[model samples]
Target: MKGRILLVEDDETFRSFLQTVLEEAGHDVLMASDGLSGARLIKGQQFDLVVSDLKMPGKSGLELFRDAMRDADPPRFIFLTAFGTVEEAVGAMKDGAFDFLTKPLEDPDALVRVVDRALEGLQRSRDYLALKESEAGGLPPEELIFAGSAMQPIRKLVHNVAGTTANVLIYGESGTGKELVARTIHLLSPRGGGAFVPLNCAAIPENLLESELFGHEKGAFTGAVQARLGKFELAKGGTIFLDEIGEMPVALQAKLLRVLQERVFERVGGGKEIRADVRVIAATNRDLAEEVAEKRFREDLFYRLNVFPVNLPPLRERRDIIPLLTEYFIRRFCRLVGKKLKGIESEALRAMKAYTWPGNIRELQNVVERAVILAQDTVRAVNLPDALVGAGGPAAAGRDKLKMVERDLIVQALEQHGGNRRQAAEELGMSRRTLQYKLKEFGLLG
Candidate 1:
C-alpha cells in the first residue's frame, strides 16, 4: 500500500524529519516548506494523501485543504497541530480532512499507522467503485473469471502485471473471454477509479477507425456535424482495451504504435497533441506472429503491444470447470429471466461437459440462457441442444458420431487445400502434427 504523499511544514528541520520518516515508511514523500508551494503541487499533480502543519507561512494548512477540495477527487488530508491548536485540527476534520495529529509526536508508528489506514481506505473506495461499474456492465465475479486449475497461471500473471503500466496482450480463441480478462486487470489496477473504455477493432469500419481512436474535430471528414472524443480521450487516467486487435488494418497499427512510443496523439484533422495517459490492454485471437510473417500485421506494432502476454485456455481445454461455469450461468440467467428452477439435471450437465464448446464460455452462457428460458422446472437433457444431448447419450453412439463428424471435417480441410497438410492444419486451427495424429486416429492416413 505504498503511496505518493505530500508533506507540508513551515519549519525546515521538522519538514526534513517528517520527510525522512514517511520515506522510510515506504511512501514517496514530496516536501514543501510552506502552504503556498503545497497548494501549487496539489493543483498540478495527484497524491494519495496530504500531511500539512496546521499553521504555515503564506497560505496555512486549512486554506490549502480548502483549495484542494475544489478538485473532484481531492487527496485526503492529515493536519499537524500543536496542543493549543487541537480544536482547529478537529474543525478541519469536520470539513473533510481525514484525521489530525497533535504536535510533539508521541510515536512515529502512529503516523505510519494513520497513513496506512488512509491509503487502505482509498484502495477500498476504488475497489467499491470498480465493483459497481462491473456490476452495471454485467461482468462476472473475480473468482468466476479465474476459475479452474488451467487459469491459475493466468491469474498469477494478471496479479503480477496489474500493478504496473505495462501494455498487456491477451491471446486466446474467439469467445474465450479476452475482454473479461482485460476488465479484470483494469479493476485491479491503480487506475481502477477511472474509466475503462473498450473498443472492438474488427467491429469498426476501416474508413472510420482512425477517427474512432483519436477522435475527430468538427468537419474532419464528410460528416462534419460536431466534434467527438475518441476512445483514448474517454479513457484518460485509466485503461483502453482494444479487442480483436489483430483485425486492425496495418496502416492504423502504425498510428497505435506511435501512441505507445510517444505517449501522445492528435485528434483527426486537429493539430493539438493530447497526452495518452492511458494503459493499453490489447487482445487478439489470431496468431500474430504468423500474421506478421505474412505481412498482414506490422512487426513493430506487434512488439509494442506484446509487452506482457497472457494466453487464455479455451473452454474445451478446461472441461473440468464445465459444471462450475454451467451452474454459475444457470443461476445468473435464472435471476435475469425470473426463473426459480433448481439447476441443470445431471445428464444435462454431463451433455455439456462432453460437447466440445467451439465458441467457449460465451457460447456456453448463451446455451444456458436459452435452456433456462425453455425449461419448466429444471434443465434436463430434453431442454439442452440436440448436439449436446446426443453427445452425452449412449456412450458408444456419441463416440461414433463425434468421430464421424471430426473425420468429415478433416477430409474437407484436406480436400480444400489439395492434400496440403500444413494449409489444412492452418484452416482447422490446429498444428500439422495434431492433424497428422488425427488422420492416423481416423484411419485417414491412407
Candidate 2:
C-alpha cells in the first residue's frame, strides 16, 4: 500500500522536484520547507514515513528524529545529507534513521527500495505496539484456542474495523478465543503500533471494577494514594479488549456506554472529562437479549455494545480443521518443551478423531501437550496418553470396550509370530479372525 511521507528540505527547487517524483511513484508526500516547520507539522499530522534533510535551521534532522519519537505513533525516518559526514550519517541511523541519502543523488530505484523496507519496519512496529496496548489495557480474551465457521466472518470484520476507533462486541462460547480475535484485529489495523489494554469484567469485584476501568484520583477512595489513568486512558489511540463484558454491573454498563458513544469518561472520583481515542472490543458468552429482558443487563448498554456480534462455533461442527489445529498445537508445545516429534499413530489419531471435545480446542491442546510431554522418546502412537484413549466423552468411553472385542484377534496374530503381531497379522491372523468370531460366542477377546 502507498504510505504518507513527510519530506523536509530547505531547498525549494529540490523539494518541489522530489515531491513530484514521489507523487508520480504513487506516494502521498507532504513537503516542509525546514526542520522546525517539519516538527511542528508532525504533531498534527500522522505520516507513515518521513524524509528530512540532515542539516537545517532552528532544528536539525537528528533533533526532529528525537521529537518524532514522542508522538503517539512516530514515522520511519530517512535522512537527506547535502554535505554528508559519515560520522553524522551513522549517528542518524543509530538514532532510528531509516537510511541516509548522500549529496549526489544516486539511483531513485534504490531510494524506492529503501522506502519499501522502511515502510515494512514501520508496519511491524505499528503492529507490535498495537498488540501490546490491547494486551496491557483491555479486558483481554483469555482463551487462546479458536474454532468454528464463526471465525471466517470475524476475521473479515476485524480487517474492516481495525482501521477505525469503533467499539466492537464479540459473542461466543467461553473458550471461543475472543481475545485472540481482538488482538488479531488490532494487529491488522493502522493503530497496531499502539497499546492493547485488556481487562476481565467478570474477574474483578464489582466495587473495584469501575475504578479499574476508569482510574480514581489520588485520595479519592481509601486506598487512593496515587492518581492513575484507567484502562481506557492507558489504551489511548490503540485498543481496549473487554472480556466477559456481560458480567459488568448495570451501573458500570451505563458509564461504558457513555465512553463508547461519546469518546469521553471521568475518573471514578474525578470530574475531569478524558477523551478516549481507544478502540473497544468486548466479548461475552451470555445471551445478552435474555439478560436484558431479565433486567440483569442494561438494555441501552447492551444496544451500545452490540455493534458487531461474532459467534464462534463449538469444535464438533468444524471437524475438517481439527487436524490443522492439532498440528498447530503440536508444533507449538513440542517447540516449547524442546522436543521434535515426527507425528502421531493411526490408531491414536482414530481415537482422537472419534472424541467429542466438550471443552473444545482448549481441551484438545492440553491433551496433546500432555501427551508430547509424557512421551519417552520421539512422539508416536504409544507416546499418546492412554487417557486420550478413554478421556473426553462417549467415544473415548466406548473405545476401550471396542478394543476388548478386537483383542483375541490381536492375540492370534501375536501367537502366530511367536507373540509378534507383525508377523502373525501378515500370515495366519486372517484365519484367526474366523476362529475368533466363534470364540466371540464364548466371550474371550482381550
Candidate 3:
C-alpha cells in the first residue's frame, strides 16, 4: 500500500538514503532532520506512518511519539536504534511503535519488508472502512437543519467521529429525531456511500424480529417458504440503524452482543456463520442505564454499544428551533400539497413556540402539515389545534396551560373507563389507535 510517510533522522546521509529507498518503493516520503521537526510536521499534516531515530538532539523519538498520540488519528510509528540500543528499541515498541529497526542497516531490504507489512495492514483497514462507507451514502453536513445551541455539540460530535469506526448510541425522547441524527452521522462518515438500513425493534413482533435481523432459510420456520436476507445482510458494507434499541428483547440482546463482539453472526435456523461488515448505530428513548440496573438490559451489551453516546435535547429545551422548523415544514408541505401559502402568520408562529412540544419535531411536522392542508393563503392561528391557541394568556406562555388541560383530559378519560383503552376511545369519540397513539405521545403509557 503506497502512502505518505514521514522520516525523521538527524544524520543527513542516512535520511537521504532512507528517503531514496522509500521513494523507489512507490511511497511518498517526507524527511525531517530532527525529532522536533518531525513532530511539527505530524501536527500540520496527515501521514500514514512515521519513521524516526530513537535518539535525537531535541524532542527524542519517544517524546515525539508521546506527542503524536494526543491526536485523534495518530500516524503509525517505527523507530531506528543502534546495535547496542536494541533493548531501548524494544521498549519503544511497547510504547506503541509500529516496529523498531537497528542502525548500520543490514539487508537494506528488511526496512522495505517492515514498511510493506505496515502499509498492507493499513490498506486492509482502509479497505474495510471504505467498503462500509461506500455503501452507506449520507447527506452533506450543510443539509441538516437546526438553530439551537443545544444541537451544536451534538453536531460537532457527529463530525468528529464520522471518519472513525466507532459504534454510536443515540439517547433521546421519542419524536426527538434520533433516527435523523443516526442518518446524519452515517452520511458524514467515510462510509457515506453505503446503505443506511433502519429497523425499529419495538415495532416488530418478538417472534419475527430475530428473523428480520438475521434472516432465515427455506422451511426454517412454519411459514418460511423461501430463503431470505436479513437487515444485517442487506446492510452489508453500510450501516444498520436499530431504533428503539432499549426495547430489544433480553434474549436477543445476547445474540446482538455476540455479533458485535465477533463481527459475525448466523442466520436464524442457519448453521453457517455470516460475516457482518456493517456498522451498527443504535438509538432509544428509554434510559438503558436504568434498564441495566433493573436487569431489563445487559450491562456488557450496553457498554459495547455505548462506545460513543450522543444525547439529543428535547424540543421543549430547544424552543428556539420551533420557528425555523415551522417555516421549513410549511414550505415542505406546501410544495407537497400544492398549497399557495406565502408564509406562517406571526400569531401561528407565536402559538407554536409557546406550546410545549411533548411530541417534539415529529409533532411539529404533523402540525405544520395539517396547517398547510387547512390554510387558504398563510397559516394562521385558526389553522392550528384549539389546544394550542385556545388558552387565555400571551400565546408564548399558554403552553403550560395547554399541557395542564391535555393532562387533565387524559386523566379524566382514563378514570372514566378504568384505564380500558377501548372504552376510553369510545368515550373520547376517537379511534382506539388514535387514543393509544395519543397516550404514548403524551407520555401517559406508564
Candidate 4:
C-alpha cells in the first residue's frame, strides 16, 4: 500500500537520506527543509502521513502538527528526535502523533514498519467513514444478508478470502446479492478501512467506460470540462467492485487486464502512470468460463480475477428461509408506511415458499412492500400479487397441496439435522415453538 508522504527535517543530509528510504519503499515523498516550509506544504496539498523532526528552525514540528490539525482532514504524523528530546517526542505522541523514531536510526526497517502502520491506520479511518455512509444509505444487517442455510458456506468462504489480497470473482444470477457479498468482504478484510467503490460495467456506454474506470484529464474528450478521478483512483487503498464485468468491452478488458497485471494504469488520455493499489472483486451473472472458452473474454483476465470463486445460490434453492425474509420485509414496510399489522397470513407465506422466486430476494422485498400498503391489518392471500395467489385456486385441494409442501419442508429439515429440533428450527429460519406447533399440526410429533 504505497502512500503520499511528506518529509520534514532541518538537516539536509538526514532529510535526503530519509527521502531516499521512503521513495525506495514505494511511497511518493515530498521534502521540506524546515517546519515552516512543511507547514506551507501541508496547507497546499494532501498527504497520507508526515515524518518530521521534533525541533526545527523558525516554526517547530509541534507547531506545524497543531496547524495541520485545523484542516478538515489531517495527515498522520511521525516525529524524529534525538536522545535528549525523546521526552518531547513522547509528549507529541500523547498529542496524537503516530510514533517517533530516535535519531541515529538503529535500523531502517523500523522506520518502514512504522510508516506502513501509520498509512494502514489512515486507510482504516477512511474505511470507517465509508462504512458509516453505506449504513446511512440503508445496507441490510448481516443476519438478513446471510439468512438461509444455502448462504452458510458462502458466509464462511467470504470470511476466508476477505483477509487475503486475492482477487474474487462472484458467480450468481442477477438480483442474487453479489454486490452485497462484495461489500461484506471489504468490511471484513484488512482493507475494510478503505473505500468500497462499485461500478456496473454494463450500465456505462463502451465509449465512456474507459474514462469511468481510469479517469480523464481536462479536455481529454469533447465533454471533458475538467479533470475527474475515476473509480480506480477513488478506490485507492480500498476495494473496487466491478459489477457485470462480463459486459466490459474487449478493448477495455485489455486495459483492465493490464491494470491487474502491472498494478498501474494510465488515464484515458494522460501519459503518467498511476498505481492502482486497490483490491479487485469482480462479479458477473454470465458464465465467465464459457465466455472465456468462446473467446469473448480474455483467458488471462479470467484467470487473474478467478483466484477465488464464490457462487451464490438463488432464492428458490433457499426456500426454507422464505418465512424469515418475509417477516423482515413485513416489519420494515410496516414501519415505512406507519402501519401496525399482525404479519403475513400463513396462506400467503405458503404461497411465497411454494412459488419459485425467479426474481429472487429483490422481487420478494418489492412484493412485501406492496402488500403492506394494500393490507388493512394483516398481509393476507388477497394482499399478495395476483400471480402468486391466482396460481392456487380457492379450493380445498389447493390449500391441501400447500399444507403438504410445508410439511415436507419441516420433515426434510428435521431429517437433515438428525431429529434435533433446535437445529432444524434454526435451519428453517423459525422459532422452536413454531416448529413444534407445525410438527403437531402435521401429525409428525407421534
Q: Which ten residues in a row have the lowest lDDT in candidate 2?
A: 138-147
How do the residues 1-446 of candidate 2 rate in per-residue lDDT, one tens digit apiece?
57899999998988887787788778999989998899888988889988888888889888999889877667888888866465787787887777988865667776777888888777876565555654454322222233345456656666777676566788665555677777787777766757878999999999999999989899889988999888988999888999998889988888988997888999988999999888888998766786797788999888877776676665655565667677666777777888888766666666677665656677777778887897655456565656666554576557657766666666665676775433665565366334433333333433
Model 3, position 221, has a per-residue lDDT of 95
TM-score: model 4 vs. ground truth: 0.62
Per-model TM-score versus the true fold: 0.73, 0.63, 0.61, 0.62
Model 4 lDDT per residue over 1-446, tens place: 68999999999998898888899999999999999899999999999999999889998999999899888999999999989999988888898999999998879889999999998888777756655665456555566778888999999999899999999999877778899899989987888867899999999998999999999999999999999899999999999999999999888889999999999999877999999999999999776886786688999999999999999988878887889888888887887779999998889888888776667888888899999999998999999887777544565467678889999999999999998877999999999757865774576865
Ranked by lDDT, the better of candidates 1 and 4 is 1
C-alpha local distance difference test of each model: 0.89, 0.74, 0.84, 0.88
Report the poorest 10 consecutive residues by lDDT, candidate 1. 437-446
| Top candidate (lDDT) | 1
In model 3, the Cα lDDT at residue 4 comes to 90
lDDT at position 391, candidate 1: 75
Query: Best by TM-score, which number?
Result: 1
For candidate 3, what's the RMSD? 12.4
Model 3 poorest 10 in a row by lDDT: 134-143
